[model samples]
Target: MQRYFVTPAGLTETEVVLEGDDARHLATVMRAKAGDPFVACDGEGTEYVAEAAEVSPGRVVGRIVQRRASASEMRWRVTVAQSLPKGDKLETVIQKGTEAGAYAFQPFLSRRTVVQYDDRKEAKRVERWRKIAKEAAEQAHRGRVPEVGAVASWKALLAGFAEYDAVWLCYEEEGRAGVGLKPVLRAFGSSLGEGETPNLLLVVGPEGGFAPEEAEQAIAAGAACVGLGRRILRTETAALVALAAIGYESGEMGG
Candidate 1:
């Protein structure tokens, strides 16, 4: 079934009102009419089976048939804190990252970051990134939209390490750092309760990769600095690989 994310306020006792861009898409793009069925999510883990009851100039109303838990979201929450890369790399990162099951994305300004953003530019970038994430989520059948947050400095990101259960930094220079992500992942899995959820924060550097001192700073902030593998991956590729690994390791992929 087709699915769209809606706000909780848009949902009433027996119906959901689709407005704004969604309405525009349904009215003009999709040509949706009364009696057409579709799924709607509140982006807070609730999914509604609905059928169009009314279609208007600026809105489409759907009467709810059922409400259920969202199965599209991963059991583990993975947040990607990526260093700003040049060009449209961040857009690709947000799009693909959402499909790979990232819960949130934080764009950071690292020592070797090529893209520089002032306050005004950062806000604009964040808005654009968020739109990409939303579209990606819809395409990926995700029940919730991954949040694209404001840009942060490396130091600011490090200070927030305590919020995550597991923090990982993909550093090329960490090959000989004596830390392997496998063991850490195993230990994390072993410590979890029967149905306990994992909260992971993955830190990916920019095109130039993390500076030696920056890697040290991440390590000091309780993040395990581990190598992706022998051949280095691009900034966007690294985060996708890490997120996929986390999903598979956390049993999110399959039995």
Candidate 2:
């Protein structure tokens, strides 16, 4: 069944409405008729099994058949604080990272970041990134879409470190030293109190990687410098590797 993330306005007490692209996909592309079934999510963790009741050119309404809990959300929330890389790599990160169960994304500027920060055009980029997250969430059957935040500076990024229970800096230097990610995650998990779900932050560098001073500042701000493995990864690949490792460790992936 196809799934969609709907707003409050799109859902009602007994029916669900899909507009624009979703509507066209259902009505024209799928050629759905009355009684065709599909899944609907409110993007607040609630899901419904619904059947098409009314299908039109640009709109489709469905009657709710069953409501149930969404089982796809990860128990531990992981936020990726990525330094801006060149071109459209950030878009790939957000899309694949959402599929990999990232709770949110924060793009920041590191000392070695190459992209010129433009405050004027940032809002549009953020909006597009958010849309990518939404579409990715639906495709992955995620209960909710990951949030895409506006770009922040180095200082601003470190100041928000207090919010997470644990922060890891994915550094190639650590990778070369063979400091594995698994052991660090296991240690961090063991230190948490019983029944505590941790909010984790993974800080990744840009194409040129982090400056030595920037890494020092991050370590001072309660971040533990960790490595993915001996093999160095692209800035976009590091977070996904970390997220997959976390999923396996947390039992979300079949061990």
Candidate 3:
């Protein structure tokens, strides 16, 4: 069944009203009509099996048939703090990162960051990124839409390190001494007792990677400077890789 993320207000009294772009997509793109079945999620881990009760000019009303907890979301919470990359790469990162089960995304401006965002443009950019995350979450059957936060500077990013249980910075210059991300992950796993939720934050740098001084600063801010193996991955690819690794280590993938 096709899945969509609806606001809690959109879902009420056993019916979900799909309006805005979603309704347009269903009416024109998907050609959905009355009786067609789909899934509507509240973006709070609840999935409702629904059928089209009414289709109109600008809306599609779905009557809920059944409701259940969402299965696509991972038990662990992982946030990716990515340095803003140039062009459409941020879109790709938002999409893939949502599918990989990221809880939130924070775009940071690093010392080596090539792209600069002014206050006005930054708001527009965050809105666009959030839309991407929403669509991606719906498509991937994610229980919740990953949040796209406002752009942060390196200092701001480092200052927020204490909020997460574990923080890993993907650094290119780090050698074999830092190559073992899995061991640290295992140690983190051991530290968690049963029923404890894992909270991980991954920081990926820009195309130019993190500056030496910046990396040192991040390490001092309680982030582990970890290497993602030998080959250098693109900024977008690096975030996805870290998300996947964290998901696997947290048993979202097979244990």
The global C-alpha lDDT for each of the candidates, from Candidate 1 onward, is: 0.87, 0.92, 0.87
Q: Model 3, which residues run further than 4 Å from truth?
A: 176-178
**Model 1 RMSD to the real structure?**
1.5
- Count of steric clashes across candidates, in order: 0, 0, 0
Residue 128, model 3: lDDT of 91
lDDT at position 214, candidate 2: 84
lDDT (10s digit) by residue, model 1, range 1-255? 677899878998899988988888877788888998888889988889999888765898999999998888888899999999889998999999999999999988988888767787777778899999998998898989999989898889999999999899998875455455677677888899998987889999999998888878887889888777667789989999888878888898797
State which candidate, 1 or 2, has the greater lDDT: 2
TM-score computed on alpha carbons, candidate 3: 0.95
Judge candidate 3 against the unseen true structure and give its global Cα lDDT, from 0 to 1: 0.87
Q: Write the per-residue lDDT of candidate 3 for residues 1-255, one digit (tens) a residue.
A: 888888877889789989989888887888898999988888888889999999875899999999999888877788889998998898999998898899999998998888866788888888999999999998888988998999998889989999998899998876345575787788898889997987878999999998899888988899998888777889989988877777888898786
What's the residue-level lDDT of 152 in candidate 1?
A: 90
Could you give candidate 2's per-residue lDDT for residues 1-255 as a string of tens digits? 999888899998899999998899889888999999999999888998999999996999999999999989887899999999999999999999999999999999988888888999999999999999999999999999899999999999999999999999998898898887889988877787765778999999999888888889999999999988888689989899999999888768764
Candidate 1 global TM-score:
0.95
- Candidate 3: residue 149 lDDT (0-100): 93
Instruction: After superposing candidate 1 on the true structure, give the runs of residues whose Cα lies further than 4 Å from its correct spot.
Output: 176-180
Q: State how far residue 138 of model 2 sits from its true place (Å).
A: 0.9
